[model samples]
Target: MKNLIKINSKINENGSIDFKELNIDDFKEFDYYRIVNPITKEIFYNDNGKLKLIHNCHCYDIWGNNKSCDYCVSTNALVTNSTKKKLEQIDGNLFLARVFPIIFDDKTYVLELFQDIGDSYVKTENENLQLSQIVTQLNLLASKDSFSGLFSHGFMYNKIMEITRDNIMPVALLCMDIDNMKYINDNFGHYEGDVLIKKISDELIKLNSDNVFAARTGGDEFQVIFINYTKEMALDYSKPILDNLEKILIKDNYYASTSWAIEDRIKNQNAKELIESADSKMYKVKDIHHKN
Candidate 1:
């Protein structure tokens, strides 16, 4: 039955299943269906037979996990070229997922059909609110850096990739690293070093807005992404941050300082290249600071 359905289904040029054209109602048994890129975890909802890609959303979002599932049936179906099933439990709700691999435009994708299997129970308003709060807290713990209260490196990387791939233009990448961090940690106590880092992070947090995303990428490294801003505007925005850092006194004589570089998005540049460009320029600034 599955083989006959697969042979009859028409694949559109955009790699979506032409459900209306095929007039196949075999999928009506499933409560909901989604097509997913097994490798990237990119999700697409099947809308009346056409697949519509969901932006900045992954399969993991539903599971509330920081990473991919250990035993992902979608990827497994893609590998084995057969149907697979997994029973998943999320927030006390049970769901059964049927995964099957399909090929379109020479690319393989997984079709996941999900059905709720948990005991039917109506929840009170308070229960729904509690579930919402739990999910929000879980997401925050997954995406936020513990110490700095900023977005984590993994979150930043995924966000940048989403922005770039979606062609959300006029974005700027600003990479910054603390100056003489090793020296500070060695000469001053590590406690003082921690204090300095916190101070810098506090300043970065103040810069966060709807269009600006700041993240603590490493021990002494940070990244601030400015969306819908040109190079000059991003520079103007960052100037006050630099000024604020200059005012942060770690000790009586020494002040906190950072070397930063900003790179505006260019045509055909991926997220990694944009970050590396700013990172390379930041090192040059750091060299000049060292010499001075």
Candidate 2:
């Protein structure tokens, strides 16, 4: 999903996008156009993730779906407050999907646009150009995660290796995970659990400053790499997230118990070793918290 259209110069506080002035004919090049309410998450779908049609759109004609797509990009864009652009393969046909967040009618929504680009691009580009484009596409695929605005795990691993191999100075790694996530999902429902996860991710985003890279490595696990940071400094930085998250409670227990381990970059340490050491420390902290 890419920023395919500049629909509005700025989104207002009420979350309304005014496209009344734009000519719809100019957007005829797009294959599909739809709007989604992100805050409601009340798309035309069953509570159990089934697609159910509630709005009139070209979805039925394009994909034969009366309901929201299972892998809706709007859902993710709202969670991350970021634009989502990607190539999607729908029923063997390829499409370029672009999901953009828009404020409309005092509510947060998303504009979803797609174009069928299956074989057209391949046939249009020359052989040499296609090869170069494929390489660039592969690089992007390895760099960013699809679901949220976080660095990909593979890219994070490469960063760790580069820092350790070069013996970079003033580098530290913090590994953190949400506590009792399964319990939350089971009891509070997955929808609410997803909201909780988004909240946690948002908190982590707040801590993303200069040289601090954050990534989601596991189901409920997050890894942070800090350039020019120490264990104590990392803890100090994470304190705000901890404080902010403490207010969320579940069944009298905190919604999430976060444990992070900070490890310094050393010549002897590799990415795997650093992760292991950090995991051990994080588990110890989590254990103590659970016991208390």
My TM-score estimates for the predictions, one after another, are 0.62, 0.51
- Score candidate 1 by TM-score against the native: 0.62
**Candidate 1 residue-wise lDDT at 160:** 69
CA error at residue 162 for candidate 2, angstroms = 1.3
Candidate 1 lDDT (Cα, 0 to 1): 0.72
Maximum-lDDT candidate: 1
lDDT against true structure, model 2: 0.61
**TM-score result, candidate 2:** 0.51
The TM-score leader among the candidates is 1
Q: Residue by residue across 115-232, what tens digits does model 2's lDDT show? A: 7777543433365355445644654564566565666565566566546655647678888777778878988888777777677777776777767777776667888888778778
Cα lDDT, model 2, residue 255: 52
